[model samples]
Target chain A: MKKLISTPYLLWMAVFIIVPLIMVAYFAVTTADGAFTFDNLAAVSQYANIFVRSIYLAAIATVICLVIAYPLVMILARIDVSFQSTVLMIVMLPMWMNFLLRTYAWMTLLGNNGLINMLFGLFGLGPFRMLNTQGAVVLGMVYNYLPFMILPLYNVIVKIDKSVIDAAHDLGCNNAGTFVKVILPLSVPGVMSGITMVFVPAISTFIISRMLGGGSNLLIGDLIEMQFLGNSYNPNLGAAISLVLMVIILLIMTLLNQFDDDEDRVLM
Target chain B: MKKCLSKLYLALVMLFLYAPIFVLIVFSFNTTKSRSVMSGFTFDWYVKLFHNELILSSLWNTIIVAVIASLGATILGAAAAVGISGMKRLPKTIVMQGTNIPIMNPEIVTGVSLMLLFVFFMARMNLEMGFVTLIIAHITFDVPYVILNVIPRFRQMDPNLYEAAQDLGCNGVSAFFKVVLPEIMPGIISGFLMSFTFSLDDFVVSYFTSGTTQTLPITIYSMTRRKVSPEINALSTIIFLVVVAVLVINNVIERRNLRKRGVVR
Candidate 1:
């Protein structure tokens, strides 16, 4: 009876989730006439630079998130226990609003005649060209995904026993030493999860790049999006690109999951 | 001094996080469409937002999809979770891992993959990709979340509760409805809300599947793409307010429930 109840869901998953993915794989290797070919896969190599740029920009953003989030999470962990939830709520409140609007807010702030330049004009500085740059794209990623990094790190670090820190100190380790050896190693799971969370979204984001990067700085996402939705209109190429992206992400996640094995073992 | 510095750091991080939102909210009331320069304040944009047919229609679509998709996912996921809890090792692992695919996969991949499926099938069926496809895609991504949320509740539930109800003269269906349902009610509610929020905020998957139909995010995307407008700012302000209201109400209800359960003083 219990197994019977799950049949509908299993059927739904097969139809929607598994089958669709299979179709992506199927379409990727096929031409417009449905003839099997590797040309679609070969076509993806032309966008090699965009692939590199996506990974590069995503890495930078992930690093930036880690750098920014770690100290903030440490501070968050140290605060009064009673106040933590409220502060955490405040941290996540922006996510409740539309992310597109949040990214649009950056567009206004970074535009040549936008708020930042307006503020610069007050100091008699010439308007700097900040918008439509790779910097702006990375900024958007870091701005949007910082919370993803913070949440996981906070969850892991907060659960760490207070006496653990005392033990490091008693063992004659200084503050920096304690952080490097004790806190850092202990926070590995959080760090790994945080990196995965931020990196995946940052890499996959098309909206942030399109809104902020203008015409010049296309990422892998933009390339894939163009093949289908944009003026380019090539589903075969799009499916090939999507398949490669899935494999890349899968590879990265497999690596991350390997790192998370210790945590999984503990849970089990 | 150290404590003070930590607090200052916290404040600055908070500032970085909120500055964009603050700017958005403030500019919503600006009289002009100019994104950079702020003129005198007016409620004109807010008023105009009501008259905008495209935005209004998209908002309606978003709400409808979220409601229906979440409802479907919750029911499907809760039932699957119950079933999975009774399964043996190999099948359980296979099903659970399958459940994680949507959750773990990038939204773009999920969106395009489903688009391929729908387009292929719809072409054969001679159906257009629009509302029905959008709902299916939403539910597809949403079910994993519901399953994840609900499965934990099943683990926490006493296994004998159904038997106890049956011993009290209830049949299998009645026992489940009376006892097991209440035990997992909180999980089901949370799963529903999570699915709803995900569906509401979703843009990427909806973009691929919706065809000509527009959800709020897709509408916002196109609006932003075409040009900057104060009306978008107005919409953002409204959305922000609505989100705040819902979250606050949810929090209050959660606290009240905890109090009733004597989990909190």
Candidate 2:
């Protein structure tokens, strides 16, 4: 009887979710001629630079987001609930504007003759190139993804029982000590979720790198886009790169999940 | 000193967050086209944006697709959440893990894989890619989000409420409508809104699957690839205002609901 209700959803998932993943795997292993080959999977070694760059840039962005978000979220958690909602709304409202437009806005600001450069000129630092660099890409990532980090951390931190901290304080722990031993450990799941949320999009982001980093600093996402689009038009290789990316992300998430679980056990 | 530092830090973060958006909005009203300089304010670009046929259609397309997709995902997801809530532990876990696949997977993989599915499937069926495929893909991704939103509400619900309704002589269907629906309404609403937000903001998945079909994001993307005409800035401003209005309305409703719940409790 329950199955009857879920049939629509299950069938939809089968056709869209399960089948699409299977298609990626299939394309990853096969040649364009319909013949099975390991060549597609093996091609990951060819684009090793792109893969490494993606991971490196994404990691830096994720770390930066975490650093920025943790303190902000701590303050947010301490603030009044109604105030927190307003702040959250402020953070999230920009997301309502099209993401591409948001990213594009950065381009105009960072353009050589754009807003930032013009400001720099007023400060006697004329025409410092900011656009089309690795830093710019990381900046774009951090700018776009900081909210994803903040929201989860805020949620988890707010849910931490006040008494948990009180207990640590009553045990003669200082504020820093209480935070380190009680609060930080309790917010591990949020940290993990934040990491996943930031890193996944950062690594796979094409538009940010393309717009801000320029085409010169291509990432795995651009490679995949190229394969499907006119540049290379090799779905097999794209699928292979995608397959490798999926596995790498899955492995990272698994490790993070284990770490979070371990933290939960220690907290208990 | 600590409070001052905290405020300073938050101010810097807010500056970082709002700077680009401020730039976007500022340029929208600039009399000159150059992003570098500010001239006397004019609403010319905004007027141009209104007349832009491509932007208008894509805006229409984006809204309709978001509404239909979120509504569909909510219904399907709410049902799935209910169904899974009833299942034994093993099956429930398996189903949940399956649902999480799309939610957790990197979006590039999801986009490319779905594009692959459509390309192959459409060729076999001799169907062209357009709104149907676009909407289908959006719904596919949106369902997982909706399901994720609703499932927690399902778990938190008191099972005895349904039984109590039954004991009060309400039939199963009526009992579900009266007891279960009200309890899970917040989740369903939030799920709907989240799905709407995602569908509206989506670029990658839409980019891959939208062959000649332009949603608002796709349109903005193409526009941004160029020098980014002020029309885009104008469009962004309009879209921003609309979303802010919607969010304000949502917030008011949510607070009212909370107050009502508080009184009842």
- The numbered model that scores best in lDDT is 1
Question: Per-residue lDDT for B182-251 in model 1, tens only?
Answer: 9998899989989999999999999999999999999999999887788988898898899889888877
Among these predicted structures, which one has the highest DockQ? 1
The runs of at least 3 residues in candidate 2 whose Cα sits more than 4 Å from the true structure, single-residue gaps closed, are A262-268, B260-265
Q: For model 2, what TM-score is found for chain B?
A: 0.94
Q: Residues A1-268, candidate 1: write the lDDT tens digits.
A: 8789999999999999999999999999999889999999999999888988999999999999999999999998988986887788888898887789999999988998888898999999969998899999999999988888988898889988879999999999999999999998888888888898899989989999999999899988888889878999999999999899988888887877876655531110
Per-residue lDDT, model 2, residue A225, is 92
lDDT of 2 by residue, A115-227 (tens): 88998899889798899999999999998888888888888888999998999999999999998899998888888888989999999999999999997999999999999
Tens digit per residue, CA lDDT, model 2, B83-160: 878888998888877898877888888889989999998999988787887888889899887887787887899889
Clashing pairs in 2: none
Interface RMSD, model 2, angstroms: 1.2
Per-model lDDT: 0.90, 0.87
